[model samples]
Target: MDNYLTKTSETERPEFKIPDFIENMGPEQIHERMMASLPEDIDKMPGGFPFDYTMPTAAIASELVHYHLVRGLMAAFPEYAWGDWLDLHAKQAHLSRKPANKAAGSLTFIGKPGTVIPKGSMFCTAATAAGSSIDFLTDEEVVIEEEGRATAAITAFEAGKKGNVSQGTIVLAVRPISGLTSVTNLEAVTGGAEEETDDALYRRIQMEHSMQSFSYIGNDNDYIRWAKEVPGVGDCIVMPAWNGPGTVKLVLVDQNGEPANEKIIQDVYSHIVSEEDRSKRLLPTACSQLTVTAAAGLSISYICTGLIYDKDTTTLEQAAAEFERAVQQVYSEARESGTLIYNKVRSLITDLPGIVDFETFLINGEEKNIVLSKEEYPVTETVSFR
Candidate 1:
């Protein structure tokens, strides 16, 4: 794979390289291409046998080509060719995908004496909104143990923001129980994360290239990048000297793009402290006032209206619902690891379907480019569409 991209013949185009998409093509299509690979002078010369459309010769040739093509693409492509580009680009910095994690929370069971809530028992929220409700399974057995109540940790089967819910929301068991009376979540569920998506990872790898190595305790870029590289962290902000000289304040939001809670703040604080103690921090600051804090929340509201087209019978209410979905999609996309771009939201609304004209668009009751700090997010507090 080392010289995979090198031309089969040096006398050919010196810069010749395979199309990046070639690696992703299926075998059947590659075989078709091979079967059609007759010489330009083929028609001029008599052939012992014409190209065989129903034979394995073309497929066999394509299989070999496919193997080398894939390895060559992985070795030579700028995106995947780690050693020459990513690793060497940022002083040997390598981009790694943050693995997905399951959502976890505590579930309480109230049952009669000698009752047992075995592990893997399922429970969900009372609300029936699809995609909004979460289902969780207990992590272990919870015997009443002579008491009428017990608590056990539970986790969602899938990793995502859908698993995040407030305390006391999970009040129903998925299946009926002989002795169990009721179920409820004791604490708000958090820490569910999907694997780093291709888009997000590409952005991070590109960002690393722009981040120059720091001398001494690094600046805002250094701190922000370091914090974001953490396994569960999604985004970060650094406030240099927030508490006076040699003091730094850091804010982190979870992978869901929500502000860091006490637990997340403490985790970040502990990580920074350990890294600084070991002098592995980006800039190795001498100050110990490196504090971590959760970001402040800002609620936003939206009121939208658009006229139905002349030929369309879609009600205004239906149009409103459609608009709401479109707008939410915009927020959901960037809610994981980046700030919402106001212009992008506006653009998406303009593109919503069944709208003749946009009547009113508001964010926090104003119309402007609403830029958010790295630690801040635009929350949907209210929406009314007509």
Candidate 2:
């Protein structure tokens, strides 16, 4: 039996004539021709190439060639991606010397002529570092104190669910809207102003609601919890955080459209504004505030820790992205405090046992291969089943 095999073409080679354009072309001309042939969107942004034209065009051409080759390989399998095939090929190459499947157990190397044998598996060699794995953050020392406190509050509410289900018990409160906190009565000197007019009351209520609609009172952690416990409480939660007269005195209605608990509503309203002030007390030391204060000084990373709880229907990816965006917005104000700036995001995660790889794809002209890259992120997430 033959120990080695060589590739040979079964069909006879045909003579071909070169066109005038083809014969006269130099490397630059060849590159220009290829570039001209690319899809219009391929070279454009948003819907096009990521890099600029300054990068050597040949490098881009090489990438396209590599892509085409991968597609061609994928097309052969019709069911497997190029990455999958490459992984299988690497494994097969490893097993070839082992005596498990042997009509002949001797080793054979298949590669291009004049090429040196591979030192290590191609897939293994090309594998990235535990670049960005979920596990990378499994041990990340991130403390989501705010989120934890929010969770604890929710948990406490959930546990006492049977005790207090009053819509009044879960009142939504707000601090004065920062921009339009106070409104004055225009009828102060009106001759007929002893009693409030219905029209006047309606106008004030509409103004307060409008102000609330435009203001952000930070993440509405409490409102979300209250809404979950009581049905139709979403409207209650939508009330303005404005400090209007009789606003604090206004009755919080029940599900039947009657005042549920006016005293509790007022207390909740007062507490909301008081709580906002209390939280703001930390502003002197707040990372965001410090970023603003040090605008002419330090190059500091205004880091705040946030945790992603499973309670929300949002995925970890979505939560992480949102948190990252929040951080970026905060960090943008600190840009004058440093150079070479970009927003950095780190997840506060905890725990990993069973290992799973994230899916990665390698697409070739005719074949697409799927592979999993091992997880490796710098941040370790704290783990707790409870």
Location of the lowest summed lDDT over 10 successive residues in candidate 2: 97-106
| C-alpha TM-scores of all predictions | 0.59, 0.14
Tens digits of lDDT, candidate 1, 1-386: 24544532111123345666556456556545655676766542223244444246656656666666666555443354434343333334455666675667788888887888889999998766464557899989988757788898888777766777889899988889889998898778876777765435545656666764332446776677667666556667677778798888887766764565554565566666675466644446467578888766557677765643434756556655555545544554454446566667666554555556666677666776555655565556667665
Residue 256 displacement in candidate 2 (angstroms): 6.9
- Evaluate model 2: give its TM-score: 0.14
Q: Which pairs in model 1 have colliding backbones? A: 216-283, 217-283, 218-283
Model 2, 319-352: lDDT tens digits are 4344433333223222223221222222112211
Q: Model 1 TM-score?
A: 0.59
The CA lDDT at 170 in model 2 is: 21
